[model samples]
Target: MSDIYLFYKPFHVLSQFTDERTDEESPRTTLAEYLKVPNIYPAGRLDYDSEGLLLLTDDGELQARITHPEYKLPKTYWVQVEGDITDEALTQLSTGVELKDGRTRPAKARRMDPPKVAERSTPVKPRKGKGTSWLELTIMEGRNRQVRRMTAHVGFPTLRLIRYAIGSWTLEGLKPGRWRQTTVHMPEQTQKVTLKPRKKGRGEHAGSKTTHKAHPKTAQPKSAHRTPRKPKGGR
Candidate 1:
């Protein structure tokens, strides 16, 4: 059995527990500052500049299930972007955007009203001569800064990114820098099934045999483009 937690990560807080960049004399705000739980780790990362709900767990299997791309769990983000986004841009975002890595899957994108949340310590720098708009974008895949890249591809660079929900979990009542213990109901264990190769012709070499091995679900390593979720900044 494993314990789960939902944390509302605040701006400028590192998603991880340690700060390799600084020693004890110059310690920065990390997960250790807000969460006192031992042995729990973040499932997926939210960049240092972003903020919102982050899932933490002590179970490796549960973590893999949530972070692996095969599950296709949707992550919804509330993004504040530069410029008055046009319908065409929104459509492009919903359809798919061409990123440097590859084309993203079609997403659920729509204009949104300003969200009511805790204010950031520092305000977003006003665009030189551009207006801003809010958008609610939902993506099923967790790529490196996917939302920010997608918006930028559609000509609306993101100014603030907040992940509001991941799969069924949400930041409903959690406040910035606050956390709570929780549980995840996982499926019951089932026997593994492996398919063996069918019998070959009678004359065929009896010594030759084949078997199909099922690949176990696993979590991927961090990616090159994936930014570190460290204590450094805001929304």
Candidate 2:
């Protein structure tokens, strides 16, 4: 089976194996320090500011399967926005958004009323006379800060972003800086085939002759504490 890891990366930690700017006064934490296994790389990158389930694997084929755009794995996010989300904004997000880069794919977005989300340690700045709202969005693409950009485009700037799930894997029970290993059933092309046992060679018999012999007996050594010929000699 291929080796795959699910890491719950904390906010402000770089996703790279090593920090390029290690000379700085405060170097960023990286995945290499947390994961000791060798030859594994991240399937895709999560922005340093975002926190959630991040995938790593030693199998390049599995990595390609997950990160390649053609596979189209869905990523679910729990987002907090600056203002109350309108039905129009939800519709726009579901339909599509025309960003400067290009039009994004249609997404699944909905307002989460009475959101059952964890409170952030660092609260976002509250605008005057404006209330915040929560939303759950699932998208197929992994663009840079796409969730935040999309929300901002819809006139509701995202204040906090947390990814909850990726494909069938979720970040349940994983705390910040903690990780877990999970197995994914890859496509047939990626699975390894077991070879059948070869037939016995010529002159090899099913039942081979065997012999057994009784073991030879040996004299036991006397203990050092035993007196030798005590009766024959006087002290």
Candidate 3:
């Protein structure tokens, strides 16, 4: 069986399990501090300064689905910006924001009341004189520092950023530095259930074909290079 972990990552912690920084005067915080799991890898990197839901898993295919740009999984963030954001800025974000890389795709953007997320382990120190407002912005593309750049392009610099959700998963009930493991259906498995019906079996309803063709072995990257298997039953 494969396992997926939803971690509520906190501010000031590196998204990586190991800090590759060789010049650090002090030990920096990393996922290893809170998560002791072995072998599982984070599907995507959240900025060290950004806080919120991060998905890690032991399944490579699952990881690819969650992280690859082709899937277009929607990621939403609760962003606190330096200005009391205006509708004009929201409209620009909803339409498209031109970045150095290129123009970002249209997004779902709107003002939000202050969110009830846990305070950062190190408190956010906003600029002394500027006012701030919150925005709930959803984007499908994961360009580097995209949200920060988009808000800044429109003259409202991001002060504090919290990723609130990815796809259908949310940070609900998870607090900073905490995590929970759960089963996620592979896309094919989900499709199988919706595509057809089959012969009934004992303890199952009539015309039921819901069971997946279980491999029993742990899930692996479908396209990863591995030694060719000998013929089944070894001739």
What digit string (tens of lDDT, one per residue) describes model 2 on residues 1-235? 3556767777777777776674888877777667776677777888877777787777665566667787677899888898889999999999989988888899999878644545455667768988888899999997778898999999999887888887756666566666665443323332222212122212222122212111111112213342211111100
- Candidate 2, residue 15: lDDT: 76
Over the stretch 171-220, how does candidate 3's per-residue lDDT look in tens digits?
A: 77677888766655434332321213221222222232222322322132
What value does the lDDT take at residue 105 in candidate 1? Answer: 93
lDDT of 1: 0.72
Name the runs in model 2 displaced over 4 angstroms: 113-121, 187-235
RMSD (CA, Å), candidate 3 to true, equals 10.5
Model 1 agreement with the true structure over 111-149: per-residue lDDT tens digits: 999899898866777579987899999999877788998
**C-alpha lDDT of residue 1 in model 2:** 35
| Per-residue lDDT value at 148 in model 1 | 90
The stretch of ten residues in a row with the least summed lDDT in candidate 3 is: 226-235
By lDDT, the better pick of 1 and 3 is 3
Tell me the RMSD of model 2 versus the true structure: 24.7
Candidate 1 TM-score over all chains jointly: 0.78
